[model samples]
Target: MTQEKFEHIYQRAEERKGGETQLENLIYQPLSNDDLRCITDDRWLAGFTEKVFQCGISWNVVRKKWPNFEEVFFGFKIDSLMMLSDEMWEKKAQDPRIIRHLTKVMTIPANAMMIRSARQQHDSFSEMVAEWPSESITELWDYLKKHGKRLGGNTGAYALRQMGKDTFILSSDVESYLRQTGIIDSGRTTKRAQLAANKAFNQWQQESGRSLSEISQIIAYSCGDNRVL
Candidate 1:
């Protein structure tokens, strides 16, 4: 199977979305490296926590409870999270202010340590994230998966997206498109599959001069039963 060019994908997405204008309006642009570097570490932690908790749960529920999450977690401040004792953590799991899942609640401190480690080594977690090259985005994914709790697979990718990182998501529609083009095989999270996806996205970026997020959106829009407006 031949891989389609970005132009073809964009054209189909535009048609599905009504027009170029409409399609562009719907695209979520990523932040520049400068802007990404300016985002505080607490925000990064918050993004990761949101995505982690959102896994296997209703995003709307999480969103509605986000203020409580911030309050209970102290805005996900790294120092505050690191200071949480075992008893405090247990109390957090049982607290009605946030979701009462112990396992998910435990990930907060672990991920906070992950962020702190990066900041300790690199001066700030934002600097590390902003300096990561988009061409090898899967490496960043791997780092988060290895170092952070429950941040593997789409969880980390979605968090990165939420934090304005330039990376592609393996959404169902994007996965279908990749499968049709033979870019990935059985599992999207496997090393081989991730590498293949990275290479393909790099090629697409070279050809189209678009961000990975834009390319991902176009691929998703092209293959799915998206509403035509």
Candidate 2:
């Protein structure tokens, strides 16, 4: 869509609700080395693990247990997490402090190792993400799906957004809207669908001079009544 169409939709939402977009609250600045450093390693894993556990469950449930999650996770420190033994993992899978799903439980250390590997290569997970160009933010989604455990499709995108990467999250509302808008052809998440979605965001960003995060929110507002992550 053109910038005018985008603004018109967002303006209608603004008129109806009289509040700022979540993007405004997010204040997602253009990524840089400084932005990467602003979020430490522990915070990145915390965000990643939260999103991972939140994959198929009610968000409210996750929020409710988040304090206990942090406690069991030892504040998400990688060094401590990397050293957690298998027996501890199995015991924690049966623990009440966090969700007891073993698969999701295993992803914690697997992704910690993923981040550690990225840090060894680039200094930090946020830096690795920050260094990616805006023109191809979707590539990071693909990277995380391929490299990070239990982080495929929408999960990885949500993690990136939580970690403050400027990205377009294809929430249910946003994806449906994109399909209806002719940016995507079908509900199936084929490679072609992703390419089309990526193209549309790239075009919109070029036209509006807005970040992908901004464009995604505007698109959601344009088509749906409420924005979702």
Candidate 3:
């Protein structure tokens, strides 16, 4: 179907759920330090590292392994990651606590080095990212395809947005949430569900004057069939 036609269906679906809200209507809940740290890092290389490790695994699994990842990866410090020796790398690969994919495991140190090189040339990771134009969806897609090392794809791009790497929205879970909320009618192929979820979130923000955390709670309550909020 045509994009416009699809969008129309999505709008109809959204109307069935509850319709859209205004910009200032959302209730804002502050993000915790750990949560904020994911986005607010000077380079967001930590998120990149996490994405690298998350290859071929469910995010829930990666979430559980985050502590171990942090410890082994030097808190995702770019400089430290670049400094990892072959022995240290071998030890981390053998560690039972982390995902043990040999190729992905090896890519960590290599990508870290790449990140360092990029940073040296650009003076900052963010600067390197900034060089890519992220204004349009097409641009964002191209940029992601070009620069995303390892096995990351659209899903990874969405994760980067969630981690506050840039301001683009995408995620499968988020799209499911939006589909449930009746924001968008149809989902896109790549992270369409997540895009739908963010669309609903924007709408919720308009209607409730609440933050993402609050919206998350409400969505959870609604989805979980909680009678009492």
Candidate 4:
């Protein structure tokens, strides 16, 4: 891309600070306690709950079929998912309302089991996740790799962080924030973006003597959209 185009994209991103993007506001934002309750409600779980089953699918597709998925999956209740037999799986496998990938469909029940097991070991799911170690980046990564069996990888770790399960310095959005801030010149390769973002963030931390929260607000203000970058 031309320098002019890059600058334009950077500026657009900066303009988005405080303003909400569809992804940031509607989709990727962490769920509230009330939101979780609504999702897990008995009636909601009865027919509309398989939304989480689409973990590896593109978010766009998941969002599109979200209602249908709820209709088909009985609202994602652990019991509803647990009740799925091979016949039900086969039936839903052909359903157009959800991503029809068999392996992902199958993993829902397995994931439910894991969630239940975590609850059994701890008093609640949140408590269990809280017990997960978060002292170091390496430990955080390791914990994600081990327990996030359903979707745990770097991307999964990032998602978990967004969901408040873990705390880490790296996230895809943060990488975008760094690029928009002109902190590093590297373009979109994952490794390059990660390295650039991390270096920039560390530098910003030292130079401004600001907390991550404050820096994040600044970054968010500075780089709101990719159009400006």
**Top of the candidates by lDDT:** 1
Backbone-clash count (model 4):
24
RMSD to native, candidate 2: 3.4
Taking the tens digit of each residue's C-alpha lDDT, what string does model 2 give over 48-84?
8899889889988998998998898789899998888
- Candidate 2, superposed: residue stretches over 4 Å from native: 1-33, 227-229
* lDDT (Cα atoms) of all candidates against the true structure: 0.90, 0.77, 0.52, 0.49
- Poorest stretch of ten by lDDT in candidate 3: 1-10
Segments of candidate 3 deviating more than 4 angstroms: 1-10, 21-43, 136-148, 165-229
What is the alpha-carbon lDDT of model 1 when measured against the actual structure? Answer: 0.90
- Model 3 lDDT, full chain set: 0.52
Any runs in candidate 4 off by more than 4 Å, and if so which? Answer: 1-57, 131-141, 161-229
Q: TM-score of predicted model 1?
A: 0.97
Residue-pair clashes, model 2: 0
In order of TM-score, best first, we have 1, 2, 3, 4
Residue 213's lDDT within candidate 1 is 92
RMSD per prediction, one decimal? 1.0, 3.4, 7.6, 7.7
Candidate 3 lDDT over residue span 1-229, tens digit each: 2122223433433443454452113323443434543343323656666776665678889989888877766776766666777877887888888777666777666555555565567655445554443233334444444555562455555544555433333345444555554656663444454455455555555555544444454443333332322
Ten residues in sequence with the least summed lDDT for candidate 2: 22-31
**Model 2 residue pairs with clashes:** none
Model 1: per-residue Cα lDDT over 1-229, one tens digit each:
6778889888888888899998888898999989998998789889998998899999999999999999988988888788878999999889898888999989888888888889677978889998999999999999999999999989999999988999999999998889988889978899999999999999999999999998998888887887675
Q: Candidate 2, 82: how far from true, in Å?
A: 1.5
- Candidate 4: RMSD to truth: 7.7
- How far out, in Å, is residue 203 in model 1? 0.5
